[model samples]
Target: LFQKESHIPLPPKKDYDKVRAAIEDALDKDDYDDGSYGPVLVRLAWHASGSYDKASNTGGSNGATMRFDPERKFGANAGLEVARDLLEPIKKKFDWITYADLWTLAGAVAIEAMGGPTIPWRPGRSDKLENEGCPPDGRLPDGDKGAPHLRDIFYRMGFNDQEIVALSGAHALGRCHADRSGWINPWTNAPTTFSNAYFTELRDNKWTKKKWSGPPQYEDPTGTLMMLPTDMVLIWDKKFKPYVMKYAQDEESFFKDFAAAFSRLLELGVPFDEPGKPAPA
Candidate 1:
């Protein structure tokens, strides 16, 4: 008699650690931008989860829908293919884990591996079958916009101003590739290392609009560092300024707040079971 065998998934923590290691291994590259893909990985995690709308609760990390059409092709998600492709092998290696969990966990792992805070992450996200789960194109923040725009975007996701400021600290990690975002330059000197340097740079730099053919962006005197309108608005806005100053002065506070907010960000719209319910397969 021939009988089919069913597959069993490993314990969440055990497999999560494996996936984390795989992502960490995939991070460093001698030839990649800033010698690591950590930035883009973090961006992937952000875009994956940032689509959540607190009211409708339609789009978020729950489905890992960015893998499909229209959403993957969105301008805001531009260049994220690098991040998705980087994780593809990891997905194959840990086939039992869902894309939603893998993408969010990779973001957390990449942040920690890059010398940032330890963001608490959990499993249970399932992949959406297709693009129907994709969020609308304009959901993500526009780099060219200012303070009000930043609030509208983050507030829609149920994030308060403090959390918005905290999450913005992630700007420390990656550069804007012209081919992708139509903007160029790193936000900090050590783009691969996550730190409060982003805040410090915003506080210290004497920024002037860059004279370039590309979209408007701010630059320091040496022309080495850059800031998008959204990044600059953190300091410009009265409400966001205190948090910015707090993070710039105290790395510990920044790390703590960032970890909490980022962890929350990843968990948005995910419908985890009730406490007593059986764990998700």
Candidate 2:
């Protein structure tokens, strides 16, 4: 019989705070690629939370099942274990918190460490039982497709055109891997540092088709960086081009919109307390 103790012994909130600090510190460690692990962490959070399907109301950040076997093997999940393994020490230190919360918080922390906004977060998500989790393989967006494909994937998760564009802004921080996604190079010169370069490059660069045997993509004239066809679709399509252009022109605007959209992405399908908590003030 389950019973609440009169003097309930809960773990100190400072322990959680300390765990968060440890993660923040780890963000600065130099063992990883590009001299920082921030991009992979952002990718980890997106892969974890991007599985939501509004119609079935199943498979989002609430479960955190990617820690397990089958979900970890997902095709879209390729290379993400790098991020998960990086956070293992922090996870062991704060085993009281769920993986769902830890992964998302790591992303929030990584953003701040890279000079981005502080994402507001709470700790109520509980780990799901194995049977209660595991999203299908194709839930994530494919970089090869265009605006219609982006709409199909994101709309399945109940996001609008603006939200889809805003969320794609996260590409600013990470590169496509040749081995993983068949595309390569950071989207911006400062991929490790958060900024609006992804948008700027989209607008300013003369992107010719990458002359590679790998899947079709674009590269700048200097041929140092790469962009997926999906990224170009933002400008190719009429509906999404304006926001793309704005972000290209204004870094602060992109950061503000990205923070709002990403905050919403993390909270998708998460139930809120009464008087829904505001993002960190």
Candidate 3:
């Protein structure tokens, strides 16, 4: 008898583009926050992948483990279910794609659709069968902490100070829901657009403690915008401050660095067969 060989064939890049299109179509609705689910989608992708530990290689985007109990219930991940649920119909429509791939792809598409830089993404991640794959609690960053906390959380994921600042630039896109993170307000007036406004606002504005009942957070003089302790520390720290200023001065630089850093962020711990091509717009 002849030996038999069998394997599952991967979807071609064009099929992945169709998935991308479905994600794009699902992004905008008048009823949603800021008229787009883009910000939450980006948050979903970041939180899903941010659990990586370079030393152990245990967490990150590979397993789509956030669907599990402990990880889903993590305080840092509050309100992200909105993002995950938004992607579910797309997941059902394209049943062949893994939840891991779909979540990350929605992030890249959200960024591009919201006037941000193009993030290179690919599809190869697989789902975990059980919650055993969940990373320990506290793997994600704490908004209430400062620079030291930022460094410890990000450094564990193999990122340096520069990359930390670059990744933090993502704050330009979303607002904090009081019910979710115990913080409230957006970092910029144009919260829906992805620009260097985060860095610019952080650089140019004078942030004072918001006189409110909420957790400790900073707000601009007008009390219209806000910043977390983690965000405020980027300007106060010597090492992180320079990049913050750099991105603030040059939109092109911010876009370039953000694209590279954010792209690498979503790919953490994912095993791919080969190099990935540029993601479709």
Best model per lDDT? 1
Per-candidate clashes, comma-separated: 0, 0, 0
Count residue pairs with overlapping backbones in model 1.
0
| Winner by TM-score | 1
The predicted structure with the larger TM-score, 1 or 2, is 1
Candidate 1: segments with Cα more than 4 A from true spot: 1-14, 275-281
Candidate 2 lDDT over 98-182, as tens digits, reads 7888998888888888888767666556688887758777888888887888999999988887777777777778687777766
Superior by lDDT: candidate 2 or candidate 3: 3
Task: Provide the overall lDDT of each model, using Cα atoms, as 2-decimal numbers.
Answer: 0.91, 0.81, 0.90
My TM-score estimates for the predictions, one after another, are 0.93, 0.92, 0.93
Where model 3 places Cα greater than 4 Å from the true spot, the runs are 1-14, 275-281
How many Å off is the CA of 27 in candidate 3? 0.9
Candidate 1, residues 1-281: lDDT per residue as tens digits? 12333355435443567778888999999899899999999999999999999999878898999989889999999999999999999999888889999999999999999999888887878888984557888999999998889999999999999999999999998899989999999999999999999999999889999998999999999999999988989999999999999999999999999999999899888888853243543
Better of 1 and 2 by lDDT: 1
